[model samples]
Target: MSESYDVSYPGVRVWCRDESGSSSLVVWRSQWTPEVIRIETPTIYNRTVWTVGQARVLRDVLDAAVRCAGGGSW
Candidate 1:
């Protein structure tokens, strides 16, 4: 089985997917950051942020839910 979900709010977007026993989430945001690089004129630049480690952490949480709940560690 497989499932996917998407959530968007203002300048943020989150995508989650689960297939078989693997799950992950990808988060993206549009905002001004130091990582932005000028693409057009020197005064014009684009800002984008993509997070993957956060998604992996969330997936790990699910794998360790039992331990977090005071159950035996896996």
Candidate 2:
């Protein structure tokens, strides 16, 4: 199962998922200038950067997750 939350900052979102009883938290942030997505996985202390297009795909996935959870303002 998965859950998502809206961050205080605009264009930022966070989510967590449980798979086989393991949980991971992910954060997505939209950056300025060249335009990139910053992804952070706190469980493993890992970070990755993605292009705007890639970020949009992830955003869409998160949106679907929110919808599956019955929708919310966050």
Candidate 3:
């Protein structure tokens, strides 16, 4: 199972997720147009764009990964 939450941000819909154990984050340009989602992983400093509806379904994989290597939260 996974847990997800929406974090408030101006002009954007930010989500955090933790799946099974691994974590990652997803951000949408806005709630009006959620077709595109940006996937970000802080651990490796990687970002990618996905357009599938599944992206929204998987938004619950963003968590812990947002934390810095030194145990700092982002």
Across 1-74, the per-residue lDDT of candidate 2 in tens digits comes to 45455532353444556454544554455434347656665545567777779878987997999889999763
Judged by lDDT against the true structure, how good is candidate 2? 0.61
Model 3 segments more than 4 A misplaced: 1-26, 30-34, 59-74
TM-score order of candidates, best first? 2, 3, 1
Q: For residues 1-74, write the lDDT of model 3, one tens digit per residue.
A: 43455522332434445454555454544565566656555445657667767665554343434343344333
The 10-residue segment with the lowest total lDDT in model 3: 7-16
Query: Which regions in candidate 2 have their CA more than 4 angstroms from the true location?
Result: 1-33
User: Model 1: residues >4 Å from true position, as ranges?
Assistant: 8-50, 66-74
lDDT against the true structure, per candidate, is: 0.39, 0.61, 0.50
Write model 1 residue lDDT over 1-24, tens digit each, in one string: 324533332322333344444433
Q: Which residue window of length 10 is worst by lDDT in model 1?
A: 35-44
Top candidate when judged by TM-score against the true structure: 2
Which residue pairs does candidate 2 place in steric collision? Answer: none
| Global lDDT of model 1 | 0.39
